[model samples]
Target: MKPAHRSRRRGAPAALRWPAIATLLAAAFATSPPAAPPAAAAANPASFAANCGTKPVTLQGYFETGFPGTVELTKLFTKQYPNVTWKIREDPFAVITQDAPLVLSSPNPPDLMRTPQITGLVKDHILLNLDRFYKIFGWDKFPASDLEQLRVDPSGRPQGVGPVWAMGINYSMTGVFYNKALAAKVGIKLPPATLAQLDEDMAKAKAAGVLPVEQFDSAGNGGLIFPLQYLMADYTIAASGSVQPINAWVLDQPHATIVTHANLLAVEHLDQWIKDGYFNADANAVPYSTMMARFEHGQGLFIFDGDWESGNLDHNFPGKYGFFLFPPLKAGGKQAAMSAPLTYGIPATAKHASCAAYFLNWVQTNPAARALNVAVYGSNPGGPASLPIPPVKPGTVTAQTLAAGRVIAKEDGAMGFIANAAGPIDAEAWTPAVQKLFGGQITPQAVLTTVQADYEQELSAP
Candidate 1:
């Protein structure tokens, strides 16, 4: 059964105007794009009006929305412009459904919102389009694959193109985190290298009184589930070399298959695991910390979450924490491909477009910030972390991190999409389905009724 969680999002307030330096584009440039794209928009980086009344630009946003990189960005942002006072708000991921309508309509709509690549933001027209801006400024500093990942429509356009909205500051990849001691205690000599083998290992662990896996709550800690779902989809995609949408952009594309039978096959695999007790009974209700505890106590063998959990592995699980890909169904799929490293979201009313863009651009280039951020997020070094985690591990998530960098120098952004970032469907809609699939309340077929219906509706809606 799913565990009890706190999905409450009662205090999610919209953006409040600040009294700092907010660069007004209209006044700044005589020739900047008049409004959004297709207006034969004026060029960006347009000079702001000297009359640019420097107001106290109060940035309304959250620090805990995505991964450690975004969190790192927040820290760096405060330092960049000490004069800009911030009224930041951090809330649960489910709040997208909890308070989306309220904030979208309220007079004091947040100047900026930190979302997890949600769909409704586009369907409801709540977010500013950054496609033109990102291109003009060159967010392509990373990889083409990474850029494509940002464009979840899978039809070959970035999420910011038009109806798509909300780019990421950063995102983590999904993977399998395991405790070596638990593997030994359960009499397993090796971690499974394939999805089938993973299931086999889980069954063995369960028979020996160990929980095969520790999955977080579908409510409060739900974002952690992305890895499991990601893997399931990947298993099928590997066979076909196809990408599915997690956002609504798939519908916008002339020809895109957001929900295919093969895609549904992935959901079925997860459903079978949940039904067979691979996860904790309280999997749907357990918070991330609680699941981590399971691994620490050596009662659980593995974790289905992001690579960002690496730093916390040692102290949390204690004995030995190792990482691996999602265990593909196909023998040799590029298991190295990850969901995302991290991406940033720039606001329409950003006062420091140049500064923000520069900061983002600098983040990709600067080693210190990227290194520091990777440490905090507990993720392995990707774009730049070429070596490995240092030996002197600390108790905090930051200390047990990798030293080498894994920065995507070639820039291949081909991440599929996060359901939250995909379509017009509210991110929460998948929860009940995910829950039902596990609890035996519904079959994967039943769950797809909602999943497919939503995917279709979101795709068709204006």
Candidate 2:
């Protein structure tokens, strides 16, 4: 589940206003038909305003209310085009993930919606294919892997590869958040470059009577799962010639199974961490918020989380903390970690499809929007390869995260969340089996066997 209280930028209030897009109208001088095709109407603010005419367009947008970037961007969009009204409905991601298909399938679906339920939405033909807009807005230049997350085959059986069905406004990745003071206290000089070094650091922290790791297992076991998923990603991508088998398995492609050597090792490592007391003794008892609160209070040496927490870390901890992506087992191995798009897609039932598409394109093509994404959202707007990385303020956690994300993105090593292999896979199989492993109720191999059974059952059903 997406955390609700992750809104704060730590100690400081967020600066919500993002940079403005530079005006770049292709239609000028004695252009015959304009050298390049005009940018999508929604992407160009002036054109959208002029084309909107006198009709008042209330864009009904369904989004996870917790996302601050969407809200800030929407405010900027509406301010520029007052004729376009926004009727934004906020909902929890869990509710949206389960209910989005039915809502999108309804006759009067919202014009633009955040689609987490990619399975049913694409299968039901609810989302618009964005291939055309991709060309028009020059989105083809961004990393294909980043765009692939939104892609789905015609049948929607596998995700993360296929035609463009959605667009992400920004990108995020999973990594480790370290308390610098605690690291020094534990006699660690640099971030670990290999799993062996990390194990040593955890041992040092434990020996010094500090919590080696602070993870909240009571809610979703995200603390345990995120790092475990990252390690599995590194193994799967590096150890195979065809990452397809593993990739397909994670997406629940037909005949995919989680019972593999790499996955088994990942589970074994987590079990060992539990035995070594790397995590809090009462980890399963603490909620996610309390986990973050304790981390902020410097109770632990490391907290494995995504760049989504960069904003909070910057505002609260500032120079006191540092962030790094989880290292591979081999010192020089290709690094892989879980990453997801802050994605948005237009529904086929959208009344204002053009307007929504324009908004999507603008966030992507607009420099100001990209800057806002980096600055306010603490996320990298996976822009065209030609576009230079935007300026993130120096000496901030967001800057540190962006630097680490660039390294992994360059290696083409980012992967999808392991739990997202199937919609029900996490709650039904992964979480329960993980809890059982923590409680000694199951063995490492049994955890995979149990989750594999759920994967087969879910994917096999019509």
- By lDDT, the best candidate is 2
Model 2 C-alpha lDDT per residue in residues 1-462, reported as the tens digit of each score: 235456553434434322111123333433575342222223222233313345788889999967877888888877777887888998988888887876776667787888865765677677777765666566778888788778887677787667788888788887898998889888986678888889889988899988889988775544567767766766666567334556677766667777889878878888899999888878767777898999998899998888888887887667888888788778887777677888788776566776788788777667878877777778778778677768877878899888888887777767777777766777788777777777788999998898888888877777
Which segments of model 2 are wrong by more than 4 Å? 1-55, 219-222, 241-245
Q: For model 1, how does the per-residue alpha-carbon lDDT over 327-443 read when each residue is reduced to its tens digit?
A: 556565434334553534444444443444444444544556556555566553333224333334544333422321132122221344445433434344566666666667877
- Model 1 — TM-score against the truth? 0.69
Error of 2 at 107 (Å): 2.5
Q: Report model 2's TM-score to 2 decimal places.
A: 0.85
Candidate 1 — what's its lDDT? Answer: 0.52
Q: Following a full C-alpha superposition, what root-mean-square deviation does model 2 have from the true structure?
A: 16.9
Q: Tell me, what's the RMSD of every candidate?
A: 12.8, 16.9
